[model samples]
Target: MAQSSSGTDGERRLDLIAMGRAGVDLYGEQVGGRLEDMGSFAKYIGGSPTNTAVGASRLGLDVGLLTRVGGDHFGRFIREELEREGVDTAGVRTDPDRLTALAILGIRDPDSFPLVFYRENCADMALCVDDIDPALIARTGALLVSGTHLSRPGVFQASMKAAELMKRQGGRVVFDIDYRPVLWGLAAKENGEDRFVASAAVTESLQRILPLCDLVVGTEEEIHILGGLSDTVSALRAIRERTAALLVCKRGANGCVAIPGAVPDDLDDAVVERGFPVEVFNVLGAGDAFMAGFLRGWLRDEPLEQCCAFANACGAIVVSRHGCAPAMASWEELQLFLDRQDWPHRLRESVELEHVHWATNRHRDYPELTVLAVDHRSQFDDLLAELGAGTPEQVAHFKRLALDAVHQVAAGDPRFGVLLDGRFGARALEAAADLPYWIGRPIEVPGSRPIRFEGAPDVETSLREWPLNHVVKCLVFYHPDDDQEMKARQDRQLLRLFDACRATRHEFLLEIIASKHGPVDSTTVARVIDHIYSLGIYPDWWKLEPADDAPTWDAVQAAILRYDPLCRGIVLLGLSAPREELLAAISAAAPFGLVRGFAVGRTIFHEVAAGWLTGVIDDAGAVAALAENLRVLSDAWRTARDARQAA
Candidate 1:
């Protein structure tokens, strides 16, 4: 068994380096629609090597990708997506000369999918020898190169160079026979769905690098093309004649067979690790998923049987979901699936499976937050009415100043964030767009009893227009003891908002103010969250009125951790509490790790905002006042946090 080395600090070396294409996959949303007739598509970062790299990272590998994308918006998107998935992008370069690649695919039926590639000299194919870093290659435990990169001259040289570097460093070289017929010019330009074509030139090109690989993987058709033979066993033998690399043949639903030695006369002479029986939704990226799962075990020096099991389960899961990279399972999700005694044929329909996927796939971490809660629409309107001299425009400007105060307190720090609403704070939201603030935009109409969205009749449709960085914040005023009808209506709205957030890939912060509906104790607050969780609503963050006792915070924390351990920690809401009370609340909750930080609006900015609106203070005076207040609260939080850590 081969294993990767570790540094003196005990962190393992890079587990795998994948070199090849990176592109955007536009998967047609209409299940049975043709590519020409499909009106909507879901965009996901894709390409064989790219998907494999993301999948490996999800499966807990220190993976990197060596590819090139055009200096365009899609290029930046590719790099960002890879980084979000925890893949090292040091080797992913930008090709100024070429555009990024794209594939437009539609599921005509489970078996008959249509695809058209837009790769007329794509940037990924422009990956040259200049892009291959020997030092980067030497740090990897394995180099995995796809057949698509070897189809072109420049990319072929680059891939070969990377493979040689890995081999020189005593790292394994894994080859994925990612054979695409149209890519090799063996099919019509529109025929990107065509998987294989027999070409002597292709066989010779692949054989040139076969001996360089320690492990080789391919489907039956891909093996036929690689070996220039029609029969699977015969092709395996022919490949074995050319190289001593271990051969793994993917047999789709029938699972896979691994041949560590000679090619068997009959495939049955080898052990076939069976795959999970899943109803296929789209099979376009299953092979890449299989490769990812196999490498997850292989890099850990797990046995071939275990590797095949991981590979088969991964392929099965991806086939039951839409898109490629997004459908790839996390290691925890995989464990849940394997550990379960019964699974639905359509894995996509499993709520538990989808929840696990949603929870674990999120790469962003908000360990602590000190956010300025300026998302008060109704409160701002009341304030304007009280002042009688301020316009909506003035309130909007006030929100912008609040954002500035936030900047003054903690500029360039992600832990500090803002909860700004679109009604009066739209300008503030726009200004904070380019900043590193963890912006949370409100959708719930300020203080709606049953939860009505402000401007969005259709929440999911409206979320499509929002920037991906903006977390959706919705506040529901409800008691667990509310009337059955009201509870049902509120539950429906929250569920709809949650589903929309999931669809749009936005983090959700569910703010509960049960005191608005009825007398609220700490236990009542905990019941509200537990009740929501029981309804299968797992929000990324919870915004609750500050509780000054440990028991209440403990109960709330236990409920959250029990329901969704991946739930992003809670943030304390101000609710116009005085400075001393808010500080006490922060101090009380700080000892428990679940209480992340405070989003106190009134305590930090109410006096300043009122003074500014009533002409009692200048903009600089207002900014200074709010900034100082925020600094004090932040200092208190740090002191409590540091005390907790020391204890």
Candidate 2:
């Protein structure tokens, strides 16, 4: 690549700011079986910003690379690679002793080519805007940013500086909200909710920069978190409310839709038409490719829909090949992918069974199981007595409802054992027992209190008699009065109960009430968890709060943070508990990625018939619902955990 003459700050051309990359990616041919099947693997530029820069260059954009690579071989490779791809290296810098980002491409499964990232102390993590010439950004056309650049001590400031410079000069600032949950370091290993709250400062960091962007790109998933919105329309509403940028959300296969205009349209009737679906390739650099295509179209003043189509075409090509950019197609090559559907069809159809099995595997390693219903106000006598006074036939029906829940889970997943909010009563349990298949050996046995963690008198006897996993029921309290007496009870008597069961094999739980939890008052909760674990015990999960009322966001978070056995989200206790409070708690915890696994007995069973209404309150039906809900919670827990780690 030829070096451009040092020009005046006002006359620079295409001085792009690819502001967010902390590592380097090396692509080489795949020799392994898994690699071979995922298509030929070739070493290519890896960072999203760098990849976008390369793609733009290939598309005839005069682009500059502005990322910090380490003084090591990896960093050197990144610089060399970018230069070869026709990118301007005027902004590249080196850091001695600091390593460049490195990733190993291993095709573990042909279905998805996993790129194992190695990014502990890379030099790029040290980039400062001072490293880039201010004159360059003053004359640039667009500045690009990816989410990865916002991490610890230094790089974040550096990336932000360049973007601000570009914006100040009336240039366009582009954002790719490719939020990586893992690196955000929310609830991963740091200290639960408190640490999560602290780490969530990323939101503030993003707000500082997003306002400067001319356009922000994100997927349906990323939009949900950054914009705190669910569907496409809501995401646009939220983003537009937050920043003055044109927000474009990438919808895979279903096509892409850009929120029309800079302001969100209340014309809830605002028009949004879908773009065409192109084939999905490796998906590694698709977003970058999309940016490349979109930018090319934008520079030409193309229509919004056409811009999306170009981006889609670019993404389709990159995904089909290996790496982020070596295989990026030209304008004409992009058309070929958009016109075809066979690759997309084969990719989707070939993985149904494989995905199911993989899903089962993940459940074992990462479980997010939650049980709803059991709560503090609940007593065995109360639940048993109300068995929805019914005739013999109706009673039998209730039994079947409960039984179906237990049996369904036992049939599908080996790791699928979680407590049930059993307020629906014995009929539901009976139905679960009636189920025929035993997917795996039962984890708990019937009619037994869980074995305590420590030296409960005669603890050995309890362990011998009760099989822990089969209990499949978690106990919780929706609310606990904030009175000193209640706090004392939890700290003393309840704490002792936990103490008693520490080392026993009959492991189960009596979760503390959450909804009613108030002011810190003391450090008892955080302390007790350590005590319980010290006795070689693990809580299956915690219901988090009371069943009757919604838990305060802080209260739910504080409780969840105290323990570390991958507890599910707060379980709802009140049958009539309004979901609004839960929604608030959910929103509070979501940004930090602190929740997912949840349960509630009252919320589920209270709405239907008290006794067995064959249609409304059948026991068999409850069992089925239980199984489905368990799987849902388990999946949620797993996702948060995986994303946190990857981020």
Which prediction has the highest lDDT against the true structure?
1
Please give, for residues 1-647, the per-residue lDDT of candidate 1 as tens digits: 11235777565468898999899999888888678899988889999999999899899888889999999989999998888888888898998889999999999987899999999989999899999988788677899999988888998999999899888889999999999989999999988898877899998888889989999999999999899999999999999998898899999999999999988788978868998888988898899999999999988989889999999999998999889999999999988988985899988889899989988888667888999888888887888888787889999999999899989989789889998988888899999987887899989877677889866699998888888889998888979899999999998999999999988889899988888778877688889988999998999999998888888898899889988888888999988999999999999999998888988888887788889999999999988998899899989999999999999
lDDT of 2 by residue, 269-311 (tens): 3324354443454567777888888887776678876787788
Clash totals for all candidate models: 0, 62
Residue 598, candidate 1: alpha-carbon lDDT: 84
Candidate 2 wrong stretches, greater than 4 Å: 1-12, 26-42, 106-113, 186-200, 229-232, 262-279, 335-647
Local distance difference test, candidate 1: 0.89
Name model 1 segments beyond 4 Å from true: 1-12
TM-score of each model, paired residue for residue:
0.96, 0.47
lDDT of 1 at 424: 86
